[model samples]
Target: MANVIEEAKSGRASCRTCKKTIAKGELRLGVEQMTQFSDTPSMQWHHLLCAAGKLPGELKGALAGYEGDVPNRADIDKAMTDSIKSGKAKPGAFPYIDKAPTGRAKCMQCDETIEKDSWRVAVERELEVNGFMRKSPGYMHPKCVAPNLENVGGTMEDLVSQVKTNSLIDEADMDAVVEEMTGEGGGDGGE
Candidate 1:
């Protein structure tokens, strides 16, 4: 392997396939095409995978006589993952969270169109400093959490602010509730 520092000092090199001299400070990778212009040279331009003998046999078999390097598993995986993440591969076999694209769900407060999976709750704040003031603190979908507050509208904000000071009132007394409504947990004494 040629030292990158040494190659940089020597300056321009050409891609074997294009025969164009690559200028200084050009971003390049080992597998990217390159050539050595010499009257008599032992070294020759080789596809990085072919030179490294890293090409998978199955991929090579699929290519038949095509000599160029095929993408490795990591490259293929990254591309697939990127496709899934970018919404380009709908119904792809992405291993992460399952996604179902429903139409936009309007925010109760701001009314901004949010993806069904990207809704947020704007809880009102009740605590006032110096005077009575209200504010809405937005709670967001797991995925769209970062920008939840930005989309809140005036009406929703007021509602959210009003809610902050009020504790939730539940009519049902959970402590006095039976463990089971069915025969289990002594709900009914069996014969």
Candidate 2:
């Protein structure tokens, strides 16, 4: 029902994080996922190390309650800590601010490339894919966030609160993002 750490009963499960099969008897992290087909949630399996990198917070909680021996416990713990500090492990859902890992993503509002290592905002946007509409994270420059949200019937106040709650970035980076969003600090006037 909840996230768990357990030995793989068989080699049939592939890790959701790495898309690799977990050998039988290997320790795996199981994150409970809700499926549209059923009321009961199913477990999504991940290799212990992979889970540590991708689902650090969830894995940490499950690891805390597990009674069995975990090989490389120290290594896993270190990886989880590093992941959190790097902002690579997202703590919550959309509407967060993080440094862009790469420069490939363009800002949805201004149609400008979000340079690597620069602050960017992520918001949920609906897209039509293969004739079906799906919601996915859309990236935007910090300055463009307010205007884009306002254009879409979203409020800056609500967004600022969500970003504060959801962002994994440190205090300094968060302050910069908030200032840019509110136009309180000099942000090139979002030119």
Candidate 3:
């Protein structure tokens, strides 16, 4: 399928990522795909920045194809660059951590509260399937990392290193994460 990025011809398009209108004459990204229910082609529209973030590879070529000046072209390019550094530019596996940013989540392993601002290990978890299913990203307590890592075939050291390299983490902060997992930081290690 062909991917194209150009200014909106009409003000009716909504960004697939942000669900906001793309004003006429503003740059928009149009991802072409066959309609889900039909062989006819369709376009998914997103604002320039939204597309750059969600479709980094497509953006590189689409930008090359557009004839007019792209606003914040550098910013979008940087977002794509950062996404590459952060392991989000492509889709595979690169687990990491973040402060719960919110406390609405529970640990998939132990089913306990993941308190706000507490560090969470993001892991791709698979379901009980007879065949194959796409794994879902879920949160786990640092204490619960061991069993889950065994289940998912990854190592804590690898995960920690990945988080450090792909994210803005402090040396001391990651050290604390280690200490927590090893039971040196307190709380029965992540019990």
Q: Compared with the true structure, what per-residue lDDT tens digits does model 1 show for residues 138-188?
A: 333323322343343344234322222121111121111111111134433
User: Over the full model, what C-alpha lDDT does candidate 3 score relative to the true structure?
Assistant: 0.71
- Alpha-carbon shift of residue 148 in model 3 (angstroms): 43
Q: Any runs in candidate 1 off by more than 4 Å, and if so which?
A: 1-71, 93-97, 103-115, 118-191
The predicted structure with the larger TM-score, 1 or 2, is 2
Please report the TM-score between candidate 3 and the true structure.
Answer: 0.46
Local accuracy by lDDT, each model: 0.31, 0.81, 0.71
Off by over 4 Å in 2: 1-83, 86-88, 151-153, 186-191
Highest lDDT, which number?
2
Residue 30's lDDT in candidate 2:
91
20-117 in candidate 2: lDDT tens per residue?
99999999999889999999999899998998888876776677569999998989978887888876576545567888899999998999899999
Report how far residue 171 has shifted in candidate 3, in Å: 28
> Cα-based RMSD of the predictions, in order?
23.2, 8.2, 10.0
* Winner by TM-score between candidate 3 and candidate 1: 3
Clashing pairs for predicted structure model 2, backbone only = none
